[model samples]
Target chain A: MNSPLLDVRDLVVRYGPVTAVDRLSFTLDAGETLALNGPSGCGKSSTALAVLRLRRPDGGKVRFEGRELTNLTERELRPLRPRMQPVFQDPYGSLSPRHRIRDAVAEPLKVQGTWNRTDGPARVAELLDRVGLDPSYGDRRPHELSGGQCQRAGIARALASRPQLLVLDEPVSALDASVRAGVLNLLSDLQDDLGLGYLFICHDRAVVRHFADRVVEMRDGRAVPA
Target chain B: MSSEALLSVRDLRVAFGPVEAVRGLSFDVRAREVFALVGESGAGKSLTARALLGMVPRGATTGGRVRLRGSADLAAERGRRITLVPQDALSALSPVHPVGDQLAAAVRSVRRLSRGQARARAVAALDRVGIPDAARRARAYPHEYSGGMRQRAVIAMATVNEPDVVVADEPTTALDEERREQVLRVLAEQREAVGAALVLVTHDLEVVREHADRVLVMYAGRAAEVGPSGHVLGRPRAPYTAGLLASLPQDGPRRHRLPALPGTPPAPDALGPGCAFAPRCPLATAPCRDHEPEARTVDGRLVACHHADDLSDPLREFV
Candidate 1:
């Protein structure tokens, strides 16, 4: 069998006296989806943040592609950031309201210094089409699009650098039921095509049951493998 | 007009200047039944709830008849006969006052009860909704209660006066699955105890299927389908309703791909003369694009699609 894309071991996160996440351990193989399922205040979100190194963990190791991310400095982590990206809960907050859809999608490519100003538009359009958005959607601002459209744009933006693993934090929770299924389908298809791994954090059991290959239940900041 | 209908809305229209949010919507809520208004974000589900509670925003014009039982005017029956269980329990309950005081105020609104009597009723209401330590919890401030408990408090407040109709707008949207079930059970129990009709405005189809007795599906400010929950969800006729059900992720073996409706719901301002669902409907034909289809009763369900007659169960393949 191939090596896992993400390996998180004994992860712990704390907010002063409160332990948000406690001794969490999980591994995700390439093209696999691992859903962290639990109720509110279960520390599922804290685990996601810690694994991404967006929030510093209190203890334990997070390894992406066999590299130890926990000990990496800010400067070293910046270059490795593109390999793992986050699709946040709220699309409205995740995407810049001021930036056009094209700019938002191309921002990642620009930040990673992979594409120049001249090469950005074509790549942005390609990404938009891949996420099921029309090329014309590139011209519109984030506010102009619907929640599902905005989320598709968000996915396009996340995929700009072709991340190997996507940390989805309640990705479709903010969307309406009518369109949420479409976005979930898009995510599932994207995973299949790219052979990417997903560390999905969600509270809804029905969604978790359908999406995840394996489930990890979190209770009071502790991971209970299901 | 059905004699059993506790509340009947006829030709309701809510317009904000040039943009019409709800256009000519009509439905009926039977006594002790959960009538769900299911739709997308801009489909005017919340606006209908506001209209039912007589709380439409200022500058928006509302025209229609909201008859409570046999009475035509909803203005007189607003607070006494109808109440609202708002979306956010945190914001719905006043932050400064204790939960008991908030509920007591609601109790005093309809009945000319003494202050002590109202307070006693408020505590009883809280207890009835399954809030533990009702007396102590009632005296506690809104911030002190957990999210689930706060929601139970909100339900208790709405049902304090025993209003004939209770309108709950996405009541469990902010809650987790466990809490969501708790809140739903409390709401159901309270509605049953009061024997009041419930108008539930939500985007969650799972909730509708589980709780609702009847359903009205709104697409782009128009009623797409209206029928019993079993018929609409089990054997949906309208393409929009069918597409929505087919899209939900199932719990069996993993799907190769989730069934999805391609396009998003059209904006109210961008609406055309044709059926609102025609653009995304898999079964759309030329007749669906020219003019809107009238509501046709088929097998005891009202479906407003030209091709609804020809359409099979949309969820057949998914199931």
Candidate 2:
């Protein structure tokens, strides 16, 4: 049988003496969305960070594509880092203010040793267009774009990595309602086209209910039974 | 018109250099009523709220009149007759002073009260806002209190003066849904306890739907619609209001995609000669592009749209 794209088993995360995530378990298949629904300080973000190995889990197993990630060294995980990417809440903060949008999107490709001088600029423009941004936006800096446009640019940057899974932490919470729908629609279209697994973390229940395929309600670092 | 309104704002205009943020806005806030001003971020709702309090930023030119009880000197009556509950609760309070001490100072600022009497009133105000162990919690600094507690304390401080009007500018935007509801409930209760009108400026339509009695929908620094919240939200006459409502996710079966309004709000300095929302509006006609529609009463609501009368189902285009 084909395994799920991502499997998290009994995940436990700690910050010094405080327990942030306690015995959490969830699994996601390719092209499926699993939302961590909770209020603030409920460990939803900590779980996302641990899943991406941005913060090492104190005790748990993060199995991605049939590989155990918790025991892997930083050197071992470097090659696999592009497979899962994180889209943070603050769009402006995620992208460098000084860098142009094209450079920001192309940085991933260059770092992963896939950049060619011939077609690299074209690829960045393609990525920008794929995420519903105008190709001309690539020349502008993060501050030059609106909140929604910046978020779209951030998504374009994430897509440049050609990731299999995305850990979106309150991706649209900072955007206005009118702009948020467009971003959500773009994300849905990308997931269908790319078959990307999503770990969607959000506090708004209506958004979670509308966007997620399956949901795990969390409170105080523990999953509450639905 | 002047006799019934607790606070009447007429032809309000605020300009920063050549850019006019709020232009030709008018509304009346009745006594003990919840009047909500809702729109997108750059729709000038916040600027309108600041103008009502006579607190527009430095070097900004303001025109028109804001009269409270027939008095145009809003600066003199700011803290005593009307007060503000700001968005950031922590910044509204002093980090060094105890939460209760700040409330006492607010009370003592307007009234000539003894220190002991002011302190007693401060504790009582905290107790009224559902803060547990009000006396002890009052002694804690702003940083010591939780986010929710600090918000409730600010609400208490805003109402402690017993002002005739309280303007809350996106009071609960930073909170989650549960905490948002709790803080809004506290604000509502305090406003009721003090018998003061509330001018709530927010981008959250759900909050306005549940809390407001009357709502003013703004678009591009102009009123798109204004009426009873039930009438306006239920059967919106303006296309801008309808489009905004259609974009919200509901509590039923999930749709594949939300009908979002395309494009962004125009820059304040970049407005065209026609209606502000004409470019993005779905039902825009040639006349809509050539002429700016004036607000007129239709079916017990004020709507500024060239096609307000013809729209049978405003939500139809979106759905």
Candidate 3:
């Protein structure tokens, strides 16, 4: 319908001689949620990684807001980096154990020069509040919090840059059932409030059915639309 | 239990020294019927499956009885009697061994099926699990097959003997939505063909809703709720069950918020005096916190909660 916020066309991802994604194409509208569903190794995760240029695709085109992402150099990619953020599958792995909540959330703002040196703490506190965490949690290290808390911190960090696109890789896979529901609810609420687009990666159809505006099924590196 | 039940777990319990993983859980799994256990991690869903095939780790305290209802001499014959199709297909398979040899070992462990017989059966099993080129794939190593295909191989190995019960612990955890459905459908069909009961252990409500005939909801090392899958999942009588049912997101139309259960589930060993869920439950009462509630039949399910009646509030939606 509307011009997509993220568009992928006839893309192919390969691992050595083997082609992982064979001519796959998909598009995500701005502020909309798109779920990539398929068997493990069917190229759903690869497709997500490729959009952020994390994984180099052998063939196809990826356009973000009509700008071709594959053509951008690292230096050229800097400005748009703030508009795209990721929270990976394993929260413990995605978050730095050594970093405190404030520091982690402030890390992106610091990199983007959004919050100047003295105001970083204030920015971090605001982020913590937005994600439903108390300001006291800002002092706690990633290890001090539970899995669900760490995930919330990860979300806070993702929001620190005020990104237009959020790539959530199995965001709640590691959390308990009760906790997962909370996180999913948080994501949807955030999307509604911020007009954000999500590329939600998950194997759980139940989770996808609950959250995503549209569903895409990937198989053997091909986009199997449903 | 009827003779058609493939696996009968009677008060089965497994304790790891100080921690009791499973606290006397019991259920009957009938042939061609899929029985699902849905709960968060550490709820002892996986441990119960391990006990069915005597696979609980050595020295782990195990109590209660397990009987193969219709099958003869399952304890005497493991590989042939009842089998587990492990969750992680890649790790479950040996990288060093060819898929064919691995399948053969599975068959060899159960009975004196000839090498050729095992090969044929393996191919057939593979075919049954929806994998093409079964013969060619048999010669391939575990690494050669895709993750979905590897899972199929694991299923083939488990089904080669045509076991009476197949334990699939989160079998679709690693699969995508379409592939996950494919695998689940294959399991359903394979169970039908082999005349076996399928025990699917997962935390996924959708999987339980679509596939299982019966649902066993676990909490704090006990069956907090057990009954027909539809009834327990849809009109959950237990507070914990209601919370789980409430928290899940639905398709078609989005809701204002998912009603999340407030707190984390308790560790199996450190259960509260009253209800394990009382600490997190929105409708917890004085008795719910003072004493642990025993399971009672309400609307067919055996639910363990004094405030089970409070779960009557209509849940949000299901997509």
Candidate 4:
């Protein structure tokens, strides 16, 4: 049988003496969304960070594309880093304030040695257009865009690496209701087209119920049974 | 529903140079009622909330009257008769002082009370808001309290003197769902215990639907609709109101895409000659673009839309 795109088994994360995530397990197939739903201090974010290997888990395993990532050294995980990207809550804080939108989108390609000076600009524009931003927006900095527009640009940056998995932590919680709908629609469209797996961590129940294919209700660093 | 207004505002305008953030808006907050102001980010809800307290920023120009019980001088009774429950509890509170001392100081600022009497009142106020071991917790600094407990303490401080009105600006926006409900419940309880009118400014429609007795939907600094929460939200008469409600996720069969409002709210300086919402409105006609509609009674509610009568189920189009 074909394995899931991402698998987590009994993940545990510790911050000093505190156990932030405790024995959490979940799996996601390609083109599916799995939401970690909880309240504040419930360790939803810690699980996301552990799944991405941004924070090393104290116990258990994170398997991506049939390869365990928990035991990999930083040097060994370098190539695999491009296949998964994070879209954080604060859009403006995620992107460099000094960089233009086009340069921010182009940096991933340049770092991967796939950027040619001629077609790189066009690729950035294409990515912007794919996320519903106008190509002219490429010249503007992060401060010039609205909250919703900045989040779209952040998504454009995430897509630049051509990732198979996206870890979205409270992506729409900071936005207004109308703008949040537009961003959610954009995410749905992108998932449909690219077949990307999403580990959506959100505190809002309505949003989780509406957007996720399956949900793991969490409280106090443990998954509560539905 | 026919009670006299505790606070009345008419033709209120707040402008920064050439840009008018809130344009000729009007509303009333009746005694012991929850009046909500809801809109998008640039819709001027926060500015309107500040205007209620005569607290506009440094260079902004404020016009029109904000009368509390037939009195035009709001500054005279700022902390005594009206108070603000700000968005951030940490900033609202001083980190250096104990939580009880701050509440006591708020009481002593307006009323001539002895330190011991004010301290007693502060402990009582904290106890009323469900703080555990109020007297002990009251002596703890703001940083020592949890996020939710700090919020409860702020609510306690706002109600210690039992003002006539409480203006909470996005009080629960920073909290998670469980904590949001807890904070809102505490705020509502305090409003009831103090018998004060609540002017809640928020962008969460679900909160407005559950808590507000009456709601004012703002779009681009103008009132799009105003009525009882049940009528306005359950059966909206204005297209903008319908569109905002349609965008909310609900408990039903999940749709891959939401019926989102097409464009962003226009900046104040970029507004057109006619309806401020005309550029993004789906039902905009030539007249809607040519002339602005005034608030008029339609189906027991005040709706400022040319096509209010044309909408039976506006959500159908969005769906």
Candidate 5:
């Protein structure tokens, strides 16, 4: 209870000579919805990736629940990944188009070593319900659904493992104007119900204004208050 | 009206093979007005802008007419009268050549300008857009410049010809807030200089509020609402238009859950018999499903909705 859910300070991430994220600092508490917003190439996405250790940071500290995540090896970080997962910008790319929605949603539970044969279907059904998708859609593939539905499927998958912190990277940026609101409102509702902490990343300010409790603006490689 | 109107689109239809994208859409852009055609992706916004310049795919079965208003629609006159500044500016420029060469080639393609004259016009275009080092940057290729600057360069190439109408599609998508405001200001200034009609297509509502004089909200493939910018955006009549306004989240009053229309936007071919938006409309009735809504005037705003008469106040005013 003493430790922050996510504590990132002086985080530096680089790509060759260009520093993608420069000393970006932010912290998140339980049930807080934080948005990282900036123009394109502002290192907003890079910072989100660095937190999940998808992209290694060149320097700085990353801690989640008193655990030092920056220095952890891939094997050491494997178990911690379930509690922290990323919902990518492109839901179609993030989820396998070939896999059924149920299978996609159940993947995270299996990855975190908690999949029981009997409980898998029930858990998947529960998650699909949580994200406002019909249980019948458990068998539907990614392409069969619309953009908004696909995003909901991606969210269903992200919530399957009951992660404490979700790093959502421009999750709704690619959605239609009307559809974006549906997804954003759903995210807000889900956060309130589950007491989930979300690190929402997006380039649009209007969308972020309604969704984020606090917003951090990134420029070049640094993070500043919006 | 004859001299004041810069570009007038009359029943313009752009098709791809058998699929018609823009179906008899008509609009008029005046000398000083900022005309906006706003909708989600696949709403014929880009195609309408492309059709103006006759840049629709080669032999894509384009029909109907795009009158250059008072001017001739001949290739020579049309090119000089109207120009398109595309959305993806970096990719629009040839990767193999320098920015200077691309700009020069564009000018040479239409006008009788010499290579040297074209080069100067290119530099002036960049200068007009407020790029800091216009001369030095001319030698740089599209890849060398940042997204915002490259977009500026593309804009420069379009404005270099001093066209009468500048139709830009999603010009601010890749830019930051500061750069977006700058580009809009530059466009407004350039429109004044040439007395060009500026037709912009964007999904961003805020950009429309700031820059546009007239607003046209397209849903599916047709114009849902058309009127003065403040009337259309501030007080929308169409249910689709109202849905869009409610969907956008602003930083003011109670941050209620963003009100979202239930279903996805209808696919182009899947448009229903009555209203294209009926499937998602909360207030839709049997008549809404029987007859296609016709254009009706509500508070001076032309909206294609059966329920437009019911809408008296601004959507935000409800809050």
Candidate 6:
């Protein structure tokens, strides 16, 4: 299926004597959303971390667009970090407290050295606008925005580097039900517009049914048949 | 309200300094029925639950009547007749002690049982909630059990006393569908077995539909709509209720843009002289902005919306 954008093969993550994720394998195609549904501590978050190489796995392989990423060093993985950005569960925790919304969205672009001094603010405004936030919100701090707005800013930051795949770990679980709907619609629209792949980890069944093209249910660190 | 309801809350108000977190909320929960309080984060659902448990924040002041089984003094009868199943089970449980000890302690508080009998009852409670090898698992600590299992243990503890009212606040929000269903079913079964009324506070409309016998939709710390689950959910009489149902994602086929309510719920302290939802209400008029809508009976349902007459059932697509 067009050489899946993010391919994980038999991924294993362990903590001390316990295996948090056991021999899990999955693939994501461009413009496709894959939801990992499970209860808490069913290894959903561990699997996401292992794929991004944020947490080193005990065994197995994680490939990004056909390149093996398991044995890669942190310095070596830095070049590919922008291509697979993360939108975490807690928007407040994931974002920096001191940075303004503009800087938060522009930080990724600055890291890639892609935008010039003159073009950075325009790109930040464009990104914020893309996520359904007013450009004026760029001046506000993270604490000033509501849970929904902060999450939108988080999405804008994830898209700043033009990532091909978004590893969203419970992105909407922190927001209210009404606010979550808007964010989900924004994610769906962004996927259609940018042809992005999503590894959505969620516990809400109704959300999985509505948002994901395919559902993988995790139980006791293994993917079980649904 | 039923004449012989188990728990009757009349004009319950919780105020933290100048802000009234729960403003004049009232409801009745019948024995063995699941009563769900549905709303957003700041809608006072949690606050109302806390008031019932007599655990409102230190500075918050609660007023009006909270009669449990005809007793007006809720604080005097907190643990004896009513108990809380907290949202975060991991924190709700003691980290250092075995789960069995904690459950036994809760059981011993209400019933005059021997230590051995309480422990046996604790194991039985754990078994009732579908925990495998309950006798062995009861010896495990909170951190040792899985999140779902910890929640089950919390449920076991809450119902062990056989209280007349069980207040479960967001019990399944942290669980997935399979585990959520498992915990929900276990709680329902346990409540039924014990002959207790369940006061469920959650933001999930789908769960409310599946489990609740009656529902109270709160907006800005007020009851926006109150009725049977089918009528309130199937035919939302209030604009805010209609908007909340419309905002949920459907089961299949993604819409281009979900129909979202434009703004956030008003802060408790910033509510003006009109309906708290009028600013975000699509059908808001001068009357809605100028005067607060009092609760009125319409078609056998209690609704607090000035434009309730113009609003129609918005759950046709939802169901």
Task: Encode model 2's per-residue lDDT on B65-165: one tens digit a residue.
Answer: 89999565789888888999999998999998999999999999999999999999999999999999999998999999999999999999999989999
Interface RMSD of each: 1.3, 1.4, 2.3, 1.2, 1.9, 1.8
DockQ of each: 0.74, 0.69, 0.50, 0.76, 0.66, 0.60
Question: For candidate 3, lDDT tens digit of each residue in A119-145?
Answer: 778888888888878889999998777
lDDT of 4 at B8: 89
lDDT of 1: 0.88
lDDT of 4: 0.92
Check candidate 4 and list the clashing pairs. Answer: none
Ranking of predictions according to DockQ:
4, 1, 2, 5, 6, 3
TM-score of 5: 0.93
Q: Report residue B199 deviation for candidate 2 (angstroms).
A: 0.8
Residue-level lDDT of model 5, residues B1-319, one tens digit each, is 4356567766678777666677667667787689999998778888777777777778666676667766565355654667887888877889989898888888888888888998988877787787778888889888888877887787788777778788888988757677788778877888787778889999888889988999989877778898899888877778788888888887765348777778787777666688878888876789899887877777887788887787574364323
User: Which model scores highest in DockQ?
Assistant: 4
Better of 4 and 5 by DockQ: 4
Query: TM-score for each prediction?
Result: 0.97, 0.98, 0.85, 0.98, 0.93, 0.92
Question: Per-residue lDDT for A2-106 in model 2, tens only?
Answer: 999999999999999999999999999999999999888999999999999999999989999999999999999999999999999998999999999999999
Q: Can you write out model 6's per-residue Cα lDDT over B74-137, one digit (the tens) per residue?
A: 7767766798999998999999999999999988887899999999999999999988999999
Worst 10 residues of 3 chain A by lDDT: A217-226
- Which residue segments of model 6 deviate by more than 4 Å? A57-61, A220-223, B111-120, B130-144, B314-319
Worst 10 residues of 2 chain A by lDDT: A176-185
lDDT of 1 at A6: 91
Better of 1 and 2 by TM-score: 2
Give the per-residue Cα lDDT of candidate 4 at B238: 86
Which lDDT tens digits does candidate 4 get at residues B67-127?
Answer: 8995658898787789999999999999999999999999999999999999999999999
What lDDT does candidate 4 reach at residue A58?
A: 99
- How does candidate 2 score on lDDT? 0.92
- Off-target runs (Cα >4 Å) in candidate 2 are B70-72, B252-255
